[model samples]
Target: MTHHPTQSPQFFLTAPSPCPYIEGQFERKVFTHLVGDKAPEMNDLLTQGGFRRSQNIAYRPACETCRACVSVRIIADEFKPSKNMKRILRRNADLIGAMHDAEPTTEQYSLFRTYLDARHRKGGMSDMTVLDYAMMVEDTHVDTKIIEYRRRGPDSFITGKGQGELIAVALTDKMADGLSMVYSYYNPELEDRSLGTFLILDHIARARAAGHPHVYLGYWVEGSRKMAYKVRFGPQEHLGPKGWDRFDTEAV
Candidate 1:
């Protein structure tokens, strides 16, 4: 099959499915395929309009009557790490991350398996086989990078590549506006490190160093406490009915 460019990007809504992040509510997505020669350009447009790229699909929530999911991106150059976030950094200083080209591997799939079983056993991707994980990384048509975090090894610090068991991984997209984290997971056993928070902080630093102004953090669901931590990254701009606007709510 091939992709054809329409005058405008066509959006198709998905059938209802059980919500992965929130309980009791169903979820739907309005998505378009990112394929063929125009996939890259199409993806850029979709993402700027608040969609998240997953594999070859660009998707956004389309739940009936629900507006809980709001797009969020950090102004990297203007961001300052909070006291708590600073602590998370020093806490995980032993851990190091190496960014690699988007390539699928057995090792990545193994970590993905462990993460889903330990943290998201009840979620939709819990049953994904290695093939699915492969597609998750390799099927991307846009510029993508896979950043893997592991324990520091003998030659790692100098080489800038870690050599040890995979502790965490992030599937991120490089867009014209900023780097969008498509998905991220960690070793669920390491609760004290707050690996999730550290990853977000690191991404902000990365975007800043790369000269990108924003670091897209996907959506921030209001009522979902599990996702509430995302808002802690202060000086964020949330996409509203008007457009991307700055919001500063009291920190948790």
Candidate 2:
């Protein structure tokens, strides 16, 4: 007879810290390590249960008083880009994103540093060094990928790869039912291109092409100006006590 071992993940609670999203609120997270052969399956289950992945850790808010952080996922198949979103697409028509293995490169680290320095100077990840960035990209146990965005070259159609400077990058995970966007960063100088919005739209298109039903966008914290853009992706589902439910931004 053959014997197989079952993988069980042990969970831990984080010490409370000042919330980055809401004022006068504290944040705590319940997290578990994601490793070994069954990591992909475990990631899918935890993501569906409102957990977000960071490197090898899967965490969800466990605050005592605040229930403002809500998990959100885009309905990829039924998504229709609004006029502004269409304009963003048109504005960035010259770019193409090529999916690659989750390997860290110095080029990517340089871009990441510039982005953090310019945009998130005071954020938690502001102090990340090259080693830290490399670990973020490489320390994964699931089906993870990095999509590098650049200007479409003349031979882009033949090679399916872009050329010149790297414009943006997305670190994502492939799940059983959907694609979960772990993190993404772009060149801050190209603000006019609305690269952030373009990244989400491109992911929606990618999810649809891959026959995935949803594109997980992490948490949407209520009353956080920084998270308000997430709601613009309409017809998305928000995980609540009763499970995932359709959220109408207009009605709120």
Candidate 3:
């Protein structure tokens, strides 16, 4: 039987694995490769359609009989920082960020390994090698960029590059509407830095500066502490079957 190339996009299924975010649950995913000349274009379209990337694969939750992982994005222009978010940003004032091409390096892999070991040792990526980590950063086929955070140096304003140590790294997708944080990690040792929160805060400002309407923050599972932070970025929208639904925790 003949088939259309685009319509018959190659798809693959992942082996069942334990869910990291939720207890007593298993997870599986159906993925397709992002490669070749059209990879960037394909990645953009697939991401807009709700797929997340892992190295060369574009995937999303494909668990049988479950639809709990709903995608979400922040309407950056409308979003206002909560009291806690303001404090978090103030606490991280010393950090300076440098944006660069999505290219991987030894220092980045070192930090990535350290983060996984300290924060996600038992999770799926704990066993990843340096090469594996490189692929994660460098395999992107989209308009991907890396934001490196470090302590502000003497020449930071001019260089826009921070020094000291790579405390945090964000793998972000530069979308037409706004930035999509694909993945992020920080030096697990500095618990007080609140790098995770700072990263989101920075992205909101970034989206506003770029004249982008939204900054996609991905899913926010209600009962998960790990995901609860996503909700703090007020005046956000949660994607639903009908459309993007505006939600205000204070109003609820």
Candidate 4:
């Protein structure tokens, strides 16, 4: 009898830590590594199961006492920008996003540092060094891409690329069902352009143009003001014990 090795992944639980979203609450997680040749397939399966990727690891909140973190995915094809969203898009009209292989660069790291210092100074990733940033972008085994947003140049229409200053950056994962926005940062000084909202809108458009049905936005923690903006995108779905279902913000 011939024996073939099993390729099942092993999951481990993280020790409880202070929740970053909701104060006075603790958070734990179940995680597994995303390595080897089967990483892409495994990533897709895990993502659908409510796990989010960070570099080579896929994790989801697993607190025994709380279930506030819910997985969210925008229904890309069905999404329609609201009046304010339309205004944000118009405000960022001069910026263009060009996607490329997930390779880190000094320019990206600089922008990343500025964003962290200005907005997320107390967040978990606030102390990441340049090497850490590179690993975050290049350590993934699954299909990933880095999108660099820049001001549109005069020749942008012909080149299909942007130029002059890296205004924003997004690290995304291309899953079978949708594009997952793993991480994103932008020029905090460009508050007038509303670059953060524009990135999400741009991803929705990209997903729709590619014929994808969803755009994964990771977790939306209930009662977390920081995550309130996620629910503003209509026609979204939330993963629950019963599976993915329509999320009606009005009913919340």
Best by TM-score: 2
Clashing pairs in 1: none
Candidate 1 Cα deviation (angstroms), residue 247: 1.1
**Alpha-carbon RMSD of each model:** 1.9, 3.0, 3.1, 3.1
| lDDT by residue for model 2 (132-231), tens | 9999999898999999999999999998889999999999999989899999999999999999999999999999999999999999987788999999
- Cα lDDT of model 4 by residue, 5-104, tens digit: 2288888999999988878889999998898888999999999999999998999999988899999999999998999999999888999999999999
lDDT by candidate, in order shown: 0.86, 0.94, 0.83, 0.92
For each candidate in turn, the TM-score is: 0.92, 0.97, 0.89, 0.96
The C-alpha stretches of model 3 lying farther than 4 A from their native spots are: 1-8
Model 1 stretches with alpha carbons more than 4 Å out? 6-8, 18-26
Model 3 quality (TM-score): 0.89
Query: What is the C-alpha lDDT profile of model 3 across 1-252, one tens digit per residue?
Result: 433244446988888887777887888888997766677777777666677777777887788856777777888998888787888898999998899999998888988988998888987788999888888888776788999999999998899888997899999988888888988999988888788889999999999999998888777777887787777777888776786788775652
Candidate 1, residue 194: the lDDT equals 97
| 61 Cα displacement, candidate 4 (Å) | 0.7
- Stretches of candidate 2 off by over 4 Å are 1-6
